[model samples]
Target chain A: MAELDEIIHQPLRLRIMAALHALPASTGLEFARLKKLTGATDGNLGAHIETLARAGYVAVDKAFVGKKPQTTVTATAAGRGAFARHVATLQEIIAGKQP
Target chain B: MIDSQQASAALNDINDVVHRVRQSRIYQNASLIIVMWGALVFVGYLANYTWPPQGYTIWAVVDLIGIAGSIAIAAFSGIGPGAGAYALRLLVAFLLFIAFGIFCSAVLGHFGPRQMLVFWPLFTMLFYALAGLWFGYAFIVIALCSSALIVTAYFYAGPALLLWMAVVHGGALILGGLWMRRI
Candidate 1:
């Protein structure tokens, strides 16, 4: 039986992961756009993103865009694999194949 | 381990976020196209107003430019290998739309200049409203508001109909495109 990923099981992190995964591969979303998509506050989102980053599930890139600091987040390959398994596990549980 | 209910809820959350992301992407891409067309329409109407006898030439040029720009935007915005095909399909659809409009206004109805002025904007808005049924509410709202304004101008503006269209029709699209980005 497969288990849910503890790192992504958190609600805000799940939302963040979902948003990033929805984009085309290698395409990252800006920090502001991620926050808007997840509806998370700055400090809260920053903390959750740090957790995912530490788990090697996401990559964060900081750069300057036209004199403004910009941060983008993308799901790593491992992250995508984990997310897919997590979703599958969730479906299995819902289908009564797992506890 | 979570129960089935909790798992279901979690999946629902993921689905919700995915839907929002898809809609957000669509809004982002569509806003740029809408703004470009809005600017072009604004200029086209102003040129038509200034040069009454050159109206046909002005509109033909505007339509050509707007279609080209729209296709370019779609091509650049699209992802992966399907972009070219998507752009081709869009071009075909646009041509078909224009062809139908010409058939109605010029061949069958023989609308005068004033009727032609109102007809095209209203007709385009009808498509926008229909697109909203599949895309989102923003298109519908923009279409309805712009159509209402165009109809109002048609009945009331009398002598300055082109100027009124330049302001309301063009102005609404610009404003709506900006607003769509915010949403």
Candidate 2:
């Protein structure tokens, strides 16, 4: 049986990863949009995103759109793989194939 | 180790977030299209009001631009593979819809200029409302509000009906598109 990813197991991080995974590969969500989707405050979302970034689960791109700074987050290939496996393991658990 | 119940809850949460993301993407693409149409119709109405005799020419130009712009947006929106097929399908659907409208207004009903003015907006809004049954509530709200204003102007705006439509129909769509982006 597979184990749940401790890094992704946190509720907010789980939500974050799920949002990124839903998009087409390499497409990123802006920080404001991600925060709105996940219902996280700026600081809280920033910290969780940092954690994901460190885990190599997501790539963060910072750029200037005109004079304004913009941040976009996308799931890396490894991140998408880990998220898929995590979900499958969860499904297995629900199906009584795991403890 | 988490139990089945805990795992189920986690999966449900994931599903919820995934749904939100999908809806957001839809809103993003739709908002652009709506805004483009709104601007086009705004100008179309003003031009029609100014050149009453050339109303047909002005509107034909406006509609052609709107359709072309919408197709361009769909193609460039990064909808992934089959985007060209999707665009072709969209153009076909639009042609069919317009054909049906022409059949109803010109061949079957013989609607006059005033009736034609109101008919097209109402007819399009009806489709928007129907699409909302699948797309989201924002479309329904925009359609309903715009239709109401158009109907009101049809009865009450007198000689200024076109101007009223420019403000109400065109402005409502522009505002609604902006609002959809926030949602």
Candidate 3:
């Protein structure tokens, strides 16, 4: 059985990764939007996002949208691949098929 | 560091996130396009009924214009990649349907723009049904109503047909938009 990705195994990061993975690669959710989706406080979410970024799992684009700050977070190709493997590993564990 | 129990919990969390993503605003913008085209086509059909000779040309021009507007809206909507890709596919399919109809009209040499009344709503409603199933419930109602309208249009002649199209297609779009907004 494949080992779980330590980076994606955390509860909050897992939710973020899953949400991003559900979207197409070229698309991303804004920071505020992702916070709502994951039910994370701004500081907590920012820290975890920073962690994921440091690990090269996601790409963060910070720009001005009509004056206000907009941070769009998209899952990189590597991030998506890692998330897929992690989910598959979870499934294996649930199915009792991990070998 | 996640064992089986935590792994199960994590899986559940993933489901929740996925559900939230689906519920995001990325897909809501599709309703605006639906309403726009719906209103446009209704006006076009209404113009046709009001002016007989000029109605066909007006409807054709309006239809093309609506397609162009939809393309622009889809381009700038900031919708997710999946919905964006599906919109592109839908456009290609719509164009092919139109092309096939034109070819048939050319071959028959003076029947009618059967594609407009007959195939247009049929294809539109089919996509609506699919989108409704994927997106929300309002679309399903629109799909059924449009299907009924198309059937009714098939029997009606000339001005009456356009009237039905206006009422049914346009009505569904506006109503669907309103319903989606409530959701």
lDDT per residue, candidate 3, B70-164, as tens digits?
77777666655554786687689669867765665556544465545656667668777887787766777878877887787777655478787
i-RMSD per candidate, Å: 1.2, 0.8, 2.3
Fill in the DockQ of model 1: 0.82
For model 1 the TM-score comes to 0.96
TM-score leader? 2
**Native contacts matched by each model:** 0.91, 0.88, 0.67
What digit string (tens of lDDT, one per residue) describes model 3 on residues A65-88?
899999999999999999999999
Determine the backbone clash count of candidate 2.
Answer: 0
The interface RMSD value for candidate 3 stands at 2.3
- Pull out the clashing pairs in model 3: none
- Candidate 3: residue A6 lDDT (0-100): 88
Q: What is the lDDT of residue B111 in candidate 1?
A: 100
Worst 10 residues of 2 chain A by lDDT: A90-99
Full-model lDDT for every candidate:
0.93, 0.94, 0.80
lDDT of 2 at B12: 95
lDDT of 2 by residue, B1-183 (tens): 899999999999999999999888888888999999999999999999999999999999999999999899888887678678978988998899899999999999999999999999999999889989998999999999999999999999999999999999899989989999999
Give the CAPRI class of candidate 3. acceptable
* Candidate ordering by DockQ (highest first): 2, 1, 3
